[model samples]
Target: MTARFDVAVVGLGAMGSAALAFLAARGVKAIGFDAYFPAHALSSSHGDSRLIRLGYFEDPSYVPLLKRAYQNWRSLEARLRTDILTITGVLQIGAPDGKIVSGTRSSCELHGLAHEALDKAEMARRFPAFQLDDHEIGLLDPQGGYLRPEAAVMGYLKLAAEDGAVLHFGEKVTAVEPDDAGVTIVSDTGQYRVKKIVVATGSWIAELVPQLRRAAVPIRQVVAWYQPQDGFATQPQRMPCFLRDEGAEGSYFGFPAIGVDGVKIGRHAHFREPIDPNQPNPPVNEADLALLDGFIRKRVPGAAGLRVKATTCRYTMLPSEDFLLDHMPGEKNVVVASPCSGHGFKFTSVIGEILADLAIDGQTDLPIDAFSFARI
Candidate 1:
């Protein structure tokens, strides 16, 4: 069959939606498919918020990309005429020698980012609601806060539609075949042929592209919302998003009670339990609450009382904990764009631009060598 569009984007979450938005903005004939509707909680990019920060602790190389991401996010906000990012500042807290603390400091110093290093006493005095240990310090990124994941997904999908991109919601793509001329996609509903294909399939990535099965595995994750105590203020005005590198115990992160009454938090470490993405997520149980309760009671002052809500999400993790953004091997038109290891949501803004560039021209000026398949 002849190609029906210039590009076909699979997985309509952050990456796919953003890619379609940019591609359609450039007048490319684009079609996007999602197993469920965009912003649905079935996959990642759900929940109310995801952290976005300037001083990246993952690696210093991500600093440049993060800068572009911030700009792209704001540009999307301006065009959409809605709020996507809320700047509540971010407190990157951990032991002075911890990974997050040291890495954040290194990135800040290397990039000359605006940040303040806070000692334990200072952090306690300024952020009195958080009970920090004497050994723990903080790196405050003034340009850090949370992004509304669901809102961003829907916003981009809306803009993509306005720009003339065809989107198929609740249509699960079953197979993807790359050919010399382009790529072919088979979904439960129908079939499609396009000049290029970008796969951002999240947890179902392995099912669509079996070659990445070893490189990317979906692990179940848990996030909980807790009601605060009387004395502590969980409001956004007084509280900033925080990260705690708790050594072997695992790193924890949380946001203030902004739109919701309860403070929200999640552990950076996965449950070590891999699951079939085709199945429904396992329910949150006592074991899960027990794990987070330990941290809540010790670290966060106001979160000790009731656990209002607990939810399950998937993190398609690459073994190295980096991202995969390169084209599929020997396939000119297929791009594997998943397995961000839980930290890729913040970069979705620029990643969409890179995907559009690759889909149309087979190359991008973005420095994504770190996310190439060679490392996989």
Candidate 2:
């Protein structure tokens, strides 16, 4: 059968779901399709918890965008009447001059954000769960927290449906043919024609937009959960979400034990193990466990207890480690985003709005020049 919509959003993960919700909410005839169900384990949007922080270490310019993102998350929570973000604060630890520490501090200073600069002794005395080296320091961002990614995605889809957007699950878009009038998407089930299309396909982005083949790469990432040895020491009430820069080794992140999963730990780009989106995730093995175990033992001994469990996830990475959010080059009706480099979950709310603006208005007021495809 043939179908049509004012806008068609493929890949209903964090970005697509939000984009569809915004379009429908604005009275646009919007429809969304996903290969899997909302927040399915196969996508990058569901990992139990994803870090949200205003003090962006990657770039000081992202601070403004992050500010808007925080407000949008709160807006989503109010609309859903369900808690989406759990603020546990965030402690970034590294050398005084290191990227994680210095860069985070710069963002805070530039934005005049509320934060605390703690030396190694202070971090140890205040939060005994972490074992900081003599040279390490910590920047405590009160705005740091963790987001329930699954809940956020589902909430967005729910709002989209409530606002009269068509939702399809388990239906993959097999082919996308663009012409002078609009774009035609051929799915396994049927065909859809739309004036505009938002391609937020995550790892499968390169399939639809060939230009990103060399830019966006899907990599396998491994994260592990550990039962904290100390009583409530690594719990959310005491221990906050954290990122530790191990210098040359790699930057690592973790969440305090919120639920039964215990303390979760992962490196920024785990092994940089590239994988094909059409293939299954490689099995999590001893090497993955060993890397996490070592970080916990060396940095946060309190959370170095029995290994609860571990799993593999996918990350679409750009060589620059930045987000790509501009319209597809030469295609005015198409916009694409991917490779959040493991940090895009927190910005889903705002990004959704940005994507809707791009697809509908052909431009957005948001300062997304940094994320333009031209940069790549």
Candidate 3:
């Protein structure tokens, strides 16, 4: 007998795992597939921490979605009896006129999100981890903090399985074929027939949907953890997660000391080097660390101690850098999610719910019109 699922979510990483959990919770016969196990380092969703905040400088429209995502994360935490979100606050410091500072202020005002506008002097007095230029200022979202990427993935997948959603971990989904009858999914292990399909494959989305090959390009990203200087207060209690805009030099993001890993930091899109997701990631090289080294040394010298650990991840990018979340072109039954352009792990919870809504209900009340496929 051919096993039939009402919905099949491919790629159980950040988005797929959440979608499966939501679908199963809705009592839909859902099945999820992933090439690797949940929380695996190979996937972009495995980093120990990813930031989440309400005053989204990226766009004010995303504020509503972020609010829901925060709620969903707390619910998942309660259900799993775990701490997925930790409030250390989030700080963005840059030119008062820069995208990060100005844009964040706009979103805060538009959404009435709790925030504080801090000048360089105030920023220095509060968080002395980094040196801010006189022209630069800080926008602090007190409710913002970091989320455990691995735990969230595992938690969501566990909930999905407990709710009777079939999960195929480490099974590769090689192809997707859709027709009037439904969608046919061909995997290395077996085949499946589902009424609809959601593709959340992250970096490898193009392989399953050829039409998106040029639209979704995968690039390598690097993150490194360094031991902090003794004199500096780099712990979460003293310093919040921070993003600094160096303008032409490139943007950099970092976290306070967490666990034994020390202080972690990385350049947003190091070198913009595109890579084949199927192959092993290139080792963290001197060239990769050079940019981060100079940035930290020039700005936050307190975190410029010996590098403790370094690893590479991939980001499936779109030309616009905004997320690509919508029904496939000319294929309404197929939902494609994420290539979240580097800043997406935080939205995993809400994105999953949106994917599930689009799959089962054919539409979502979420304002994703700006992320339509027509723009790509």
C-alpha RMSD values across all candidates: 1.2, 1.2, 1.4
User: What 10-residue stretch in candidate 2 is worst by lDDT?
Assistant: 1-10
Angstrom error of the Cα, residue 89, model 1: value is 1.0
Q: Which runs of model 3 end up more than 4 angstroms from their true locations?
A: 1-3
When 1 and 3 are scored with lDDT, the better candidate is: 1
lDDT of 3 by residue, 1-376 (tens): 2537899999988989999999999999999998888767667888798988889988898898899999999999999999999999999889988988888889999988888888888987898887888888888989999999988999999999999999888899988998866888999988888899999998888898787789888899999888888435888988899888888877888889987778888888878999998899889998878877777777888878888888998877888888878888777789999759988888888998899999989899987898888887
Question: Relative to the true structure, how large is the alpha-carbon lDDT of every model?
Answer: 0.88, 0.89, 0.87
All candidates in order of lDDT, best leading: 2, 1, 3
TM-scores for every candidate against the unseen true structure = 0.98, 0.98, 0.97
TM-score of 3: 0.97
Runs with alpha carbons beyond 4 Å of true place in candidate 1: none
Counted clashes in each candidate structure:
0, 0, 0
Query: How many clashing pairs in candidate 1?
Result: 0
Candidate 2: C-alpha lDDT? 0.89
- Tens digits of per-residue lDDT, candidate 2, 273-309, equal 8998888899999899989999899888998989988
